[model samples]
Target: MNDADAQMIARRVREELARRRLSRQALADMARVSISTLEKALSGRRAFTLATVIRLEQALGVPLQKIPAASPADPLVASPDNLGAYSQNAVRWLEGRYLTLRPSFGTPGDIFAYVTIIQWDAEQGCLVFSEAERLDSSFSQSGKVSLPHLSGHIYLVTNVEGQYRLAVLGRPTIQGALYGILTTLMVGHGSQLIPAAAPFVMLRLKAETEIAFGRIEANHPDYVRYRAELDLVTSDGFAHFPK
Candidate 1:
């Protein structure tokens, strides 16, 4: 890696460490690397090997590739006019960790709660999103905003299972909440791709809320509440109806 790449990795490491409240020693222990080695990489005194990078990724629960490097050519920062394409207020409103609600696999009435993080991707000139359970260090999917005409904002994210999924987050309501639809590509027995969609909602969590790392089991209290909220949205016909 070049010096720029090394610095990018270092910055990402620091961000993750702060977000997860992990100490350098804690990360070194988790990655099975010496404190000195971790220090050297973070200090930019040494570059990380591929194997070491993987270890750090696992320890940090962040995909290093998702972290963009600093570049002056980024249009989002370089051109003021670019901001007019999307609402800065909406951008600020949408960026953060949200507790997302979706239908449970094979259980129509059941709902699953997953944590999703959204951030501005300056290089891509769009919002980048990732979803994961608290216990899972790796993101289950990565998505980016898709532009053009739309009644609401649309995101095209690729699931870890290699399926393409689309999420449409509607404009902020008076209540300051975003309701949307989640569409997944379903493969039929004949190898045809069918779009199956479900109505869902996302509520931004308070920064102080303790985020659990493991999957939210059906028996969890949040599951019932999430299902109830989603059911309400579907019943009220508030979710985006994709034509």
Candidate 2:
């Protein structure tokens, strides 16, 4: 979204919050987004992504970004549909610690490397994923895994009151490589964030000894190998991007 549209949405959100007599912290908790991101966007230092706006709309029980400022879908629903309804047995194969790689949003010519552990949530009766070993641990994500049968795709979805970040990947290759795309806000020069997206690769890790985590620069030994893996997201048809 451009600056103007983003500012307009921010204005609407402020109005809705005030009209509802809601505190920012309460809304942030309900939406499950970091307080920092919410403050930045609301203060106009950053732009709101559609996912975030939708989340906020859902949380506030009203529409903000979309004009007519009205929605046919009921906004008063207590919560989103349970995305983790798949059986444990059906998703057991996906549990593991994966070396997650994608281009860095803050740095050019570098790859962001981290660990994503997918595990079975016995209490929730479904699969969930959490990130770790990230340089910015404060922004690490954890959310439910949605495995839809007909589409044969897996989704990692995180929703914050007015923000969301998602990744969709296909079945793992024989080599245990899962390729896909991620869409989320890119932290820019300052707190400013615009809608940004890039391909991501998730490789099942064999041992903690082999891979390194954090920002992998050109000089890092793992850079060459990690860069090649992310390339496969589009080159090998695992996902597509429109030019």
Q: Please name the candidate that would achieve the greatest lDDT relative to the true structure.
A: 2
Minimum summed lDDT over a 10-residue window in model 2 is located at 72-81
Residue-wise C-alpha lDDT for candidate 2, range 73-114, written one tens digit per residue:
523211123562344433545789999999998788899999
| TM-scores for the candidates | 0.53, 0.64
Assess the local accuracy of residue 232 in candidate 1 as a C-alpha lDDT between 0 and 100: 64
Over the full model, what C-alpha lDDT does candidate 1 score relative to the true structure?
A: 0.64
**List of clashing residue pairs for candidate 2:** 31-161, 52-162, 52-163, 52-164, 56-161, 56-162
Q: After superposition, how far is residue 131 of candidate 1 from its true place, in Å?
A: 1.1
Candidate 1: worst 10 consecutive residues by lDDT? 77-86
lDDT string, candidate 1, 1-243, tens digits: 777877888998888677656689988876778999999999988888877777776444334543334366545531123222453223444568777777654454656667788887766666678887734354366766543322334454564566567777654443445677887765555878777888867777787876443445667766666667677666766664547
Model 1 backbone overlap count: 3
Best by TM-score: 2
- Overall lDDT per candidate, in order of appearance: 0.64, 0.77
